[model samples]
Target: MARRIKVLQLHPDYNIKAHDFADLGEQIFRALPPARFETVNAFLRGRPTGDQPESRAERSIYFEFSDAQLKGMRIRAMWQLFRYCRSQRFDVVICNRFKPVNMMLMLNRWLKIPLCIGIAHGFGEYDRAYRRQQTARLVSPAWRFVGVSPAVRQYLLDCRCGFTERNTVAITNAIDIVQAEGLQLSRDEARSQLGLEPHVRLVGALGRLVPVKGHIHLIRAFAQIAGAHPDAQLAIIGAGREHDRLLREVELLGLQGRVHLLGFRENALRYVRAFDIWAMPSLAEGLGLALLEGMSGRLPVIASDVPAMLPLIQGAGGIAVAPADVEGLSRALDEYLSLSDEQLQMKGEQSYRYLTERHDIEVFRQQYLELIDSALSEVTL
Candidate 1:
């Protein structure tokens, strides 16, 4: 048999749970057939803490760099990473996020890896002049840049930072519908665990409580309709610095009891079944994974009218309201609250159908496999 192609998958940091970030790194490793590929996963800034599940790659390495070390020039980290790559003679390096991608681009000038693929998760990665100029200067034929969403790909193209039609592509993120559904608790159990009454109509959101997530807008929107829909309640799941301010907002709106801030639930996907309707009022997203997770639970969705989420919301037959527009969000909530039980269930079925048909995990895996094959084939030619 020919020698197995050695691949290195680099991520900036390790997640607390194996399930976060949609397990994309492991999914990529599994895409390459074991007989033909040897995979290694490297975390640039985190080390395993007792009993935490690690990457599923054949091997895993943690550099354990600090925040200050990773910032600025990152010369020391780059030198260490370069030495590691050279010693291992990796045939392909897949860099996830900006820091890993930037460092590899500079190092590959000497390391000369056969193939280097860089993935960008969201916007504004190359917004700074120096970042763009340096990227344009160092990019080579061996490098391929992937945007996690079509909108992100367009952002890269518009930046004119050496990412062109030939070197850039978009691969929309995906989730395993079956796996996600299997993880979900039954509606009654989920509600009970979440301290939600079974009879209450619930509007739910799952994300960090950051301004970019637009949670405040959702809270204000729900407040608008609270008096009209006495049976409906709003619940947001996740934690962030905005917790105290958001709690104050809740109090100011006189929605203290009606709105629930379910902070940072582990395996939040399991509780999605507790929602009557799922809402993601994010001001921006690189393909809202939470919205897809909600769909996997067969919940009807309401999402902001942003590029990353518009197609998913429209395809799923869900409502789309303008980002940060409390009035519009309020109207959208009222529309869902008015629906009959049969109508609501049908809406949810549409979301599930859209997810299974459009964002299937199998399709995502095949796309990555094909992209890798194409890159390797180009090298041979």
Candidate 2:
């Protein structure tokens, strides 16, 4: 019998509630081939707050460290990772963040693992000079750096950030179409459940209430056009530190009734049908998975024209506005509101077609498998 490949996936955290990193990790975990691979998921931090639901895939190994230990957590995590690798003898170490990449590289100096893959989920991962320097120092021919978007891959090369053209590759983020479809709720029913009037034209945005998400800008933009379109309402979902501040802004703008701040719903994507249009005004984004989820629901999108988002929205029946520009966002919202019902339906159809053609989870899983296979072949040769 052929030897089964042993794989280990490293992550900073595995909070299922959070989007982006955790979502990507979960998708990969579910897609990894069980027949030919033995996989284990490991995290540097302990279990997240709130209920920790059991995952369907392999059980995770968390390296619980206290606050003081966290000060030098990277080093401690590195030592723990090295020990684990040594005992388990994993054929491939997939590092989900730069810190883990650094750790594996340092370990490779002695152990020489068969394959090492680093995944860059967003542009911010390598923004600092020290990070770039570390990447430059640790990068090797044996290692492959995967970017979640073309813009991200190009940014790494253009910025002269440690990653070379030969070593870097882009793989667009994807959504589980089946799961998203399953979560779908009819527009009227969804609106009714959320206490929103079915007659009102709703604009929806879902993400954490963090500053970088640009929720404040979205609210400001809605404030500019609320009076002009009194029938239109804005719904911002998800919870974070910015919740109270957002409430204050809503009150200040006298939009208490028009703008609804629906804090963190477990199945927020199901409410997509309630929205006439989806809005994402993030100041910075990796690939805007929420935008993809919105598209899956066949809703026209209005997103910031950042590098990470531009390619995803362009020519997909969506409009792109300058990040943090309230005026631009308001205008886009107004334009969408002006369109006839038929035009809106056509645009939504276009978005659905684009999503089905380009961002399927099956394609993402295959790409990852191919990359792994290619790396293994190189080592064998």
lDDT of each: 0.90, 0.83
Best by the lDDT measure: 1
lDDT of 2 by residue, 120-158 (tens): 877766778887777777677678888899988887787
**1-381, model 1: which lDDT tens digit per residue?**
899999999999986365633677777776789998899999998888888888778899999999988998888898899899999999899999999999999999999898999999998889999999999999999999888889989999999989999989998888877778778899999999999989988999999999999999999999999999999999999999989989999999999889999999988999999998999999998888899999988889999989888988999999999899999999999999999888999999999999989988888888898888899898952
* Pairs that clash in candidate 1: none
TM-score of each model, paired residue for residue? 0.98, 0.93
* Candidate 1 lDDT score relative to the true structure: 0.90
Question: Residue 236, candidate 2: how far off, in angstroms?
Answer: 0.4
- True-structure lDDT of candidate 2: 0.83
